[model samples]
Target: MYTDSATYNALLDGFCKCGQIDEAFMLFKSFRDDGFKVGIRGFSCMIDGLIRSKRIGEAEKLFQKVFDVGLVPDLILYSIMIRGLSESRRLEDATNMFRDMIGKGIVPDTQCYNMLIKGFCDVGLLDEARSLKLEISQHDQFPNTCTYTILICGLCRNGLLGEAQQIFNDMEKLGCSPSAVTFNALIDGLCKDGKLEEAHLMLYKMEIGKNPSLFLRLSQSADPILDSASLQKMVENFVDSGLILKAYKLLMQLADSGVVPNINTYNTLINGMCRAGQVNRALRLSEELQLKGHFPDSVTYSTLIEGLQRVDREGDAYKLFEQMTENGCKPNSSVYKTLLSWSCRRRKTTVAFGIWLKYLRSLAGHDGEALKLTEEFFQKGDMEKALRSLLEMESKLADFDSAPYSIWLVGLCQADRVEEALKTFSILEEFNVVVSAPGCVKLIHALCSGGKLDKAVDIFLYTMEKGYRLMPRVCNSVLQVLLDSKDNTILAFELLDKMKSMGYDLNSYLHRRTKSLLQHHYSLRKMENVAAR
Candidate 1:
């Protein structure tokens, strides 16, 4: 009584194309379970739907199901399948499947080829990617503007400016006048390469002519859409590249465009001003934003507080912190971190500890780690009393995720208790807490200084295997111990060579000092040989 299967499948396919993924899947499932004839198109539509929804694994399962049901995967099907795999970084499987498709006499379409080439470029396989482009050109269907743009952008992103520009030049020789997209890509590449003047020149040309939305278009959704927003982003890019006047002009443009500056927008401007050491202008903007009914948020206060702290205005920072709370805005982790950092800089340990405790005690639900950390800090002076308080809190709300592993690790390291630090490090592994490189470095450095060189070296090797970069200070400490003997000195050199091979420059001051000492030993040996002669 209902429309035929093709008609229904067509309707479902349309639904998928329009982003109604849930509805399409439901319809497809209903068609299958009800014994309706679901053809290759139906299967492909469902697979495409799943891929578009970012359900790549599910799409892969569906593709296998299609093969199991004896449906020959078509070009569109293979293209979509390859796309899903490529986007998820399963490039090897994608390449194999694509080759298999070619063997089946199903030559890939332009989009499919582009997808594979782009995937290779994404993972920095530039030479292989260029080969694909050459293949496309030989086939008399050289990739389109989008394909060239993607390749250029990818090459530029990988810092292969020479290759990127060569591709662009090839495009020109091919008689393809550069579009707005091409221009934007080049400008962005220039910006990345610190050629702000060139980027600005390109941007200036766009202003005098098309004023294309390509730059804004390149930015994905969740990015600001309006002209002002795009201009603001451009300003941010320039500012990040140390182009202050460029940012200022763009900020003024936002005002001229009648875009009402919100708290965040104002905060950004004030932060820029504060960074330039124009505290008076930043504060003036803060008051201006407030008068315009856009009151300063915690960030605004934090920014000013940081500025005050920078200029030795600790009293002013405290006042701003109090004012922020009075304005019904609670301080964030950053605010307390900044305050404590300032206190530490001024050697005000008591003030730092006070701020730390206030930040710790303010925690409630989902703050077990902070509370436990506070307990550990208090433990050094009063362990029995602190443990009792911590145990009581643990009884009420205990979550394994919020255990004081990091806190105890830090506390143990600070107390110079190597045994306890190692124990805490092991305990952290038991809790599945990811200890960062800095945390491990601090511990290893402390252990090395305490003559626990073997233990420290073990930890450093483990950290290195885990792809963690050791701090120079920690590496130097380990190197010092390893260079105490001739055999150890050779081992130290081997380790340094390994580090260099891993892309760490061993030309650091500490590394050079160790090298000089080793060289001195070699000179002493040569001098001894001459004396014997």
Candidate 2:
């Protein structure tokens, strides 16, 4: 019985105006399915609801769907979409739609022009706003008081106070008396321009309060009951009191009143949702952001991932991480580091390795292709090809990091390609890349085995001076090299002394063998010397 046009519009208006979207949409669907004539107001209410909820993409689709159902857009509908689009920062789209509306012979009222001009002014496009003002003035269309205030506000904000003052003076000459808002605009402009005395004089002449928000306040001409700032303040109070749902509703009311919240506001709400253990709700907000042509950044995705993990939904977290990359929002170090730790805590080896590779790739500046190729070639026992690819890739990299270089040196050592390893070491040194302890050991061992004992000793000396971590294996390997060369007896003794100082068990088999070799050489030299005597 209440599904009649008057009741339907009233219910939908009440629902949409107060931010009851779920019930509004439900009723909208039921009204249609029940064969009631859902008039133009139905579409208008739904679109307004979506826009206020920041579901701009869905609102756009609903508008098209209305047209597809054989309905044409009238002035009110066109004005709504234009206002929605312009307020959402799609200025060009709003302008193009305005042109389309005009081509169809629908004359835009002053309200429509005011919306676009306000949009232009908001984005600091004063020149474009002035031109539009001129065009409208030349036509039969008259600029309202709001239009003049918008231009004056924009000019003053852009630091063109002289022009703003001229526009303020012209307001009276053009037959539109300055409202309190108009005077406030000029006074605020003067104060912002460091003309406090002038601003005080203006305020005194206007007989308004010294405080701006307290007196000379501007109310929406169409809806003079509550201003957007009051609505926003109400929402803030609700949010501060931990009434998230209520705060969200009031925020929507502000949006319905034509004040779009900024990105920081959306982030705040999403973060609050996650903290309140409403992870799924936060995830839904992420989808709404995307639907509005706004992609979630690393923080957005990371918050949701952490929330999902807390709720024991690791699988969902991984999927979101993958989806985040697919959407082209690059992850920062904190994101991968968090994910890597998450994988480790879960004892998921594959996940940890995958995240580690991703982390390294991020550090490599999106050079995943080259990095993967180099690692793959090294794993496949193709040392020459790996070295070639690494060199080629290095030519294009503006910055050098240690991970890729360590992988190259490890591959070279494993394949016994000692010469190329030395050249790569030189390149790393030239760029001041700090190879890890494992990498230093691998290269030194390779050099000694390739009959480059002196080269190995030189690296060992440098590693010692640089305080590189010398594993027992590194000392053992250097000792073996020195023991094999009779002329290096003194160096071997010195290395053993250093090892003893570093808490190495000098009584180990390798150390004993080294000592035995040196003692045997000394005895042979003494016997030869006695025979000569």
Candidate 3:
């Protein structure tokens, strides 16, 4: 029953630190009710916890309480209040508090200034942020790595790459070593601004370590440097910019530097090559990376498999997929989806079915323990326990349910089993499971192929309603199917109109076919009417 002030303070601090703000406040209230004095540390903990929990209004109220209790807010308390306000985007209130602190002869440290600068930058007040950065020096506190990085990131976000780079240069000139975050920000800005070469060069400089003289020489030198993470990002940027060849050359140069690219770097290059339609080159790179002691990850194999499928090299893709599994790299949902989509698209129903079966088998191991428990309970004649075990198995199996069903649905559609796929799809819909876009595409294709125009249109409309963008191929297929019959010309026109309203691009061939079909339908209708008369 005898609690000391330090004990109460410790209890309050612990509760606040663990995100139990309510409990901390209750303790504070209890101590106050017991005529015990709660110090500024207790108040600081409460305020910080409230702010962190996003209860900014409550934090503000507690802060005002500090003054009501006749306690002069110290620099630490002021810093906490200022930071909370800044983070809450109440920049004006934060600035006023900051000024009040300064009026009390409290100089802001680098961290305090950085927080304010970050707040300004977050709201696109770059001018104000820069002014604050200057004020840090006026306070005789040099901006640290974090301060420079924040400004760089802010400038990059605002598309002020030039200003950002200048700050980066100034940061280095002031003997502040730029961190990985700083380099990443500047490099990301360069990449986004279509300055791939400069991004690459910057990455090279980053890898050579932080020597000013070396940075200068590297700028003019053709020698490549290696930083796995940053270089991996730059490789992606290059590929995105259609500079695959340049990215490849950079990778080759990195290889010559005796620094092997990581699996991620190889994956990026492999993905880029695949997207560029150089599947052969991508396959070769896969082999090359493996020879260099970097085996293909799930991502590498998935990217390569998808690429091969795009080029109609299903056999090679399937082989690579098997290799992926054989090499102890598990095929992810993406791999299964890719294989299913291609098999369905190409009408290789058997192949699609096999892939789906394999996916199901892969998931079988996940619920093995639960299944064993269920079997054991059943053997023991404990029906209640067996039922509970079965429920556990069901819950575990639910996690793997949606994806496999979508895959199987695609396979079913490919086998011309439209009704069954639709039934499965409806069950998914009831459970709020969204079929993948490819699954939608395959279903529509199968419906169109089966001359189920009404059903195809229904699926097409539903797919779009679900915000799934079907490929243009499926769109064209639906149109062609409708246009194949003179009777469905009006339906084709209506679907085209719907597609246009939905912002689907209408290719010229589709336009020509629709117009020709419309003309023929109208002419035939006109002739039929005349004959009737």
Give the alpha carbon lDDT tens digit for every residue of 341-373 in model 2: 555445443344455455656664556688799
Q: Model-by-model lDDT, in order?
A: 0.70, 0.71, 0.77
TM for every model, in the order presented, reads: 0.42, 0.41, 0.43
| lDDT string, candidate 1, 199-297, tens digits | 898788656664344434534446553654665565567656756655555554455345544566667767776665456667777887766677888
- If the candidates were sorted by their lDDT against the true structure, best first, what order would they fall in? 3, 2, 1
**Candidate 1 regions with alpha-carbon error over 4 angstroms:** 1-238, 245-258, 275-280, 306-313, 343-357, 363-380, 383-432, 443-452, 471-474, 485-513, 516-533
Clashing pairs in 3: none
Candidates sorted on TM-score, descending = 3, 1, 2
RMSD of each: 23.8, 27.2, 25.6
Better of 1 and 3 by lDDT: 3
Q: After superposing candidate 3 on the true structure, give the runs of residues whose Cα lies further than 4 Å from its correct spot.
A: 1-226, 258-260, 368-407, 430-432, 436-445, 448-451, 464-533
What digit string (tens of lDDT, one per residue) describes model 3 on residues 1-533? 45676787778766664455665776788567545788888888888877765688999899999989988788788888888899989999999999989998998899999889999999999999989988898888988999989999999999999989998888878989987789999999999999999999999989787443542443345543445765677688788897998898778756645455799888888887776557778888988987888778889989988877655667888899889989999998789878887776666655664565456457645566666665677567554455345444543453544555566677788678787777767766655667888788778877777778888888888877888776544566677678787677778878878878887766532445556666787788899999999
Candidate number that wins on lDDT, 2 or 3? 3
Model 2: CA > 4 A from native: 137-139, 208-533
Best candidate, lDDT-wise? Answer: 3
State the lDDT at 3 in candidate 3. 60
Q: Name the candidate, 1 or 3, with the larger TM-score value.
A: 3
